[model samples]
Target: MNIRKRYLVLILFVAIALGAVGTYVGLAFFADGTSPSGNLASSDRDLLTELADQQETIEENMGKLSKVVDAFSIIQENYVEEVEDKQLIEGAIQGMLQSLDDPYSVYMDQETMEQFNEQIESSFEGIGAEVSMTEGNVTIVAPIKDSPAEKAGLKPNDQILSVDGESVEGLDLYEAVNKIRGEKGSQVVLEIRRPGVDDLLEVELTRDAIPLETVYVDTREENGKLIGIIELTSFSENTASDFENGLADLEEQGIDGLVIDVRGNPGGLLPSVQEILSNFVPEDTPYLQIEDPSGKKTRYFSDISSAKEYPIVTLINEGSASASEILAASLNEALDYDIVGETSFGKGTVQQTVSMGDGSTIKITRMRWLTPEGNSVHEVGVEPTIEQKMPEYYYTNPVQVEEPLTFNESDDKIENVQIMLEGLGYDPGRTDGYFNKETQAAVEAFQQDQELNVTGEVDEKTAEVLQTTIIEKIRNNEDDYQLEKAIDTLTE
Candidate 1:
């Protein structure tokens, strides 16, 4: 009985010991329904494997990404410091523009871009001149005639020292313009130093509506012949229309010769220049052409029908550029018209404005203009036919004419000056030289032709003679004036 009890006790003790060990193992590593030493229940292993797979997928997708930006955005949203979104956007835009290598390609905000466009369109008000920054200071390029900037005693080659008491240091042309331009009637104080002037002159210009002088015309006899002088200031939107009207006016006044002045004219529109060239060139004559990157060529032609057939002379200067060069080149090539004055500003590249999805636009140089002879005038200026230097008198007071006898303000007498100049054997170059240098030269030649004094100066007797001969030509509808004068002189 004692031996049997001892065996049962030992069996109960071993069962208790095994149960205790299993419970301890379960609590230590498999309490959440798994096994110790890498052994696990099937359901538990499947659930854990799914979780592991999901975690691995998430890490694979996002581990490569730098979350610094996202973190920064989050911080910015909840940041204590107030930051303007527009400022940051503008800064980003500036940074982007700075990346572009072109200095002209700049990022102008809505306000600045709008202001720039308006300023270009009006091209008036403000200082009544064109300005650009050079050498870190504002520089005056050209002053328009009768403008406040011109009348208020501002001149070209003047270095602007300061604007409104602010030193224009480290500023670009755009920045200088922003400081100089203001509302009409507002004053913009500009300290300028002219070439001849020693001390810096403080020019307090009372900003006014600068009247844009597109075309200026004058009719007076030169060297005894009635001639008309026209100076085109700029090639604006309405410049072509204005030029047409000027031509008509000169024609009505019996304009014998035409002098086209294009001095200090920074070119504007392309179509306007084409329209201007049409007045002299015959129809279908190529006015200008441009070649694109894809080997495509676009050509513009003359369309005007009532252009006069007379000696035409064109005057140009260093400021003449773009459309001016186009017009001058077309006339000189097509008509062999005489060109007087200095070389033109060489800028033949055409810019095409393309707008981005954002309200910004990019004016890119799309093509370069080619002359009729396939010559590039991008850096090389057009060579003049006559290459006449502008006389001091012409540069000073271009409208003054020597002829006392004015032409009849009628179409019949419109060609009178041409006949008179041609009668004098002056060859003002083209009969189109309404009152330009060619006509003046012809008048001087007429004085010389008549065996009188040849001073290139017109006297009253010379004017009377030229006027009478031209009137006779108009009445008789004679094409040759100089021939008749020679015959009459020989008879006399």
Candidate 2:
């Protein structure tokens, strides 16, 4: 075969090996401008010879796909509505991927492909959150640090019920993402159903260009020792290099300890995290293992010979996912380091995006990534060595006020308001859902302190102020229990 033909054949072989294309129909569908002749082409024959053991299985599967071809022909010829061939083809591909029952395995159209490419290369105009389909709902994995989604108080695992008032039911992950993304400066309203909150919340966000700067470095003084902090927002393309440079700079400054925080980090490229892992994990054992479809496991190792001279700690929370989990698990399992914080957002599978000749692509979950100890954290997150919970108010849901909440109103919204009130130092008498006389008095006290109308009732203005004030306090780092624990672990 010629060079181009060889490359195409190799790509097809990879797709076939990955179970992405199991039959002649699937193969011919992506062949583009080529028609099936009930026989394999010369290149395909060569490829099949390479898979000689599976040739019988492939042929048997090919014989079973006549039903799909018949259905397509009937739909094209007899359906009352005129259907486009491209649409049907794409739908068929999407259907195959959906049959896997894995949310990470998705088919992306040309437009979504372009947007995905743009997001990886540079900035993209969107709400700036990593999301996945969970229990048939588009759920937020984590809002990017400082993005409009985070600034608007979108939290991890927040289920997106609708975008701009239109329900996202039955829509795939990519479709929901496309709906949530728009031009920079445009408005996108999201209806969120957060866990532990009774009433649904609506968040209005002004979309902006989301930059992909992943690594953030800072210094902290704890116990008369200088500690370096490297916070990874996401494991993007340059995150590994950026982290290396930042670590080098910190070392040059003669820091006593290091803290790696992946609190709200939604993972990105796999290679990126692998590169970062090599810096900490020694060559004594594999940092991680990849289990393929046939249950074959391949171990990957780093070349580092020695551990860091100073003490190191990893900080994680519910928003930490995929690559973040890998780094945390590897460091803890391989190096015996301490991990302090809440459990992570478990996502142990690794996805590989394969192009379908056209601009479209299919991201397939090719393997499950296991920790150095060969444990999978798919649905079960990594447990912290020393468990630490944030303040109660940190987990409070957003209060959506449909009407003024007066005394005797007992609902989850009232409970949220009470929690915020108490967290801000104004005692609501109790954190119960009931809005009693004391709760009303607390609202009045808060209103008066904030220089608002002392209506003694929680109204729209009061709800907004409460949310903004709590967000401000969280952003000001008035109470970061996890970071403090990490610093103490490192310094002690």
Candidate 3:
């Protein structure tokens, strides 16, 4: 549900509270003050009249509630099909709230309400992932690493066709997620279809507790100069402390340059972002500003009290959003840092989750954030300072364009091999129209690691398993391709 619905709900709650209070006070006034034994003046009579008016107002409001209850009773009794589940009613209310056309506004049911609260604490179970519905299909937005979904091989952009034999056609995103997720050790059957596949592939995966870890770090040497690479997946609850430790590790390693990879991150905690930015930015520097619908603006400043001097390069892509954008825009505009890669996923608004009495919570867009330079990045994404294309060889091969090879060994298998190789540092050439030697080498390496026959040939069984793995990785958005690209660019 949107901001409008949230405020509307709030208003309704307040009105109901006031009505109850007024009814109580009015009854007391009539019983105690307007007694026949009491000598009442004109002013007392006026006060009694005012109390009577409040009583009438309370009765009118109760009458409206009665009418609604009566209408609901009529529908429930006379409707063609029997409405058995109370959950359906809750879902309908949630759906109606969402129909207000606001992405942030939502009504959460009992299960989802608990999930939302847990999300704030930055931990949960059953397939760690963020999912969204696009074009009538449930697409994996991002999967938490080492989570059930990630371990089970979910990927970004993988369309969920069915969950446990139930067709998920009209089911919204949350509904689809609830269907896939369950208690640990429980198996969820998923029917998924890739981009260019004939039959729907069924993957039965056991659900597990998915812990949320936000900070990821590694050390790399760029032309004899060691560089510390910190890939912050998202700014969840413990992310600020996590990032601080990562920076301390870098300091211990004595790296000269730093690379912060924010690619494919959908963003998380706001203060966590500010905390991380303070590490690179100077003290009290204007970071990013926010403006609410009421035109009230709040400016957040960097608080890097004391830190080492190092050249920083923040890498971003189309998937970088919210808090990531805040940091990037702050550094890019205020500190004049170089940002690399494609345009960012422009989402400037801030959302605050509001809890309902029923245990469910609603996340509504409360405010819009702006860059330090006062740029509004709402649908218009942030463009990088240095525009770099994933080298032609990185994106695809020129030769494969004209003459594409037909794979008797499924296209899925070849692509899988290609991705593995790309991660291992040998360019798989192009992900384009063919399976070539580059792809074969990737296959060999993966096979060798698996202790399978090092034949490098994609047979039927290999193809099937390969499809499953690739589809899962893609579903998780944990592609080695993105990491490889970031590392390559840093080295270059």
RMSD of each: 26.7, 6.8, 10.7
Better of 1 and 2 by TM-score: 2
lDDT of 1 at 105: 46
Report the C-alpha lDDT of model 3 over 46-82, residue by residue, as the tens digit: 9689668766776566545554444455566688988
Q: For residues 1-492, write the lDDT of model 2, one tens digit per residue.
A: 345334433444455555543334443432221456655536977766856856666556544655665666678779999999777767888999899999999999889999888777788989999999998999999998879998788899999999999999999998899999999999999999988777789999999999988899999998899999999999876898999999999999999999999998989878888888888888888898888778988888878798788988999999999999999999899988999999999999987777676677888787799998899999998889989999989888778787899998898789889999998999899998999999999999999999999999999999999998998787666789989999999888
Model 1 is weakest, by summed lDDT over 10 consecutive residues, at 391-400
- The top-ranked prediction according to TM-score is 2
What order do candidates take by TM-score, descending?
Answer: 2, 3, 1
In Å, residue 341's CA in model 1 sits off its true spot by 1.0
List candidate 3 stretches off by more than 4 Å: 1-12, 15-92, 151-153, 193-204, 303-308, 386-458, 465-492
**Model 3, 150: alpha-carbon shift in Å?**
3.4
TM per candidate comes to 0.56, 0.88, 0.69
lDDT of 1 by residue, 1-492 (tens): 245333433443344344334444533331122356634336887968965765565445343322422443445578788776455445544555555544344555555667667644665457677764444556675666666676554544578888989988766556677888776789888878766444466666777776555888776565565667777777776788889998898988876677776766767666567677777776756667777656677665666664465567677766677777887787777666666666786778665443333455444455677776556787577766545453121111111124442322222122344554655345655444244556556666677767766665455566555644544443342442322232222222
